[model samples]
Target: MQIVKYLKQYRIPFSGLAAGKHNFEFEIDDKFFDCYEHSLIKKGQLKADVEMQKQENMLIVNFHITGVIQLTCDVCLSEFESPLDFHERALVKFTDEDWNQDTEEVLVLSKTDYELDIAGLLYEYANVRVPYYSKCAEQGMNQSCDPEMLAKLSSEAADAEEDNTEEQIDPRWDILKNIKNN
Candidate 1:
């Protein structure tokens, strides 16, 4: 498929490499997110510095990711860019078993596998760096919510409160209140 071809660049062909440390660099941009159908990060400009240590039985990969992604403010819904920097490590082990075991920090690949596809790993690293609560003033560089939008929201709330106060009470309720007072 087209998706596979696009992601081929992220595959590291380790079959012929010397058993030692190797360094790789990748540029992650808006097009990178297009590969994922439901990615939380839609737009970003990032770079990934990867260090892979290959041993006889296993490979240890370290990811250093740095970039800025566009996020929406929770308060005013305004879009802003937030800087991201994080590091994560994954362990890949080779096995002959048909059923390979994998976890967040570890991966099991068949001994016959010649390449490691890192596109999925890179996607997870970037998404996990996103904060649970995103606010423009805090995450953005010296930025705040839209003042005009905030003012409009406040005025709408005040108008709704005023309308509630102007609603007439039922005559039946008034009689009940008078009886209680007496």
Candidate 2:
């Protein structure tokens, strides 16, 4: 995967680490988002702190993300920076040929596997923190949305709602409705 090359630093080779809790830190930049073609975040700066707990049979990874990400406003298509802060945890268990991840937070890996590549996990955490609808603040110090675009979008939405309220029927469908009425 293209991500593997850029995020090679995120790979945690636990087979050699002594049984204990270990901490690793990394700084994520815009280049990290380039790995995914359809990523919502094309540019960002973030910090990640990963805490790995090694046990006899399983590994527990705790992730903390904090920083800012560049996003395009859905309302005006203007770029803005949004703060990102979240925590996520994952459980990795070792097994042989029985990789079952029906549990959302748990991952199954081969018993012989020596490392865990956490690039995907970090990406997911960052993506999850993004709001479904990102818009520049209507009233804020950093409000930078285009007024014309916002007005256009509002007018379009109002027009759409008006159209929905007054449903149009095709002539063929009208005949069917009349037959049912009779």
What is each predicted model's overall lDDT from 0 to 1? 0.91, 0.84
Candidate 1 residues lying further than 4 Å off, grouped into runs, are 167-182
Residue 117 lDDT in candidate 1: 96
lDDT tens digits, residue span 1-182, model 2: 76667888879999999998999998888888888777777888999999999998899999989898988887699888888878899999888866655376998888899999888888878887778888778422377788998899999999998886666644676777899988
| Candidate topping lDDT | 1
Q: Which ranges in model 2 have alpha carbons more than 4 Å from their true place?
A: 1-3, 138-144, 148-182
TM-score for candidate 2, please give it. 0.76
The residue pairs found clashing in candidate 2 are none
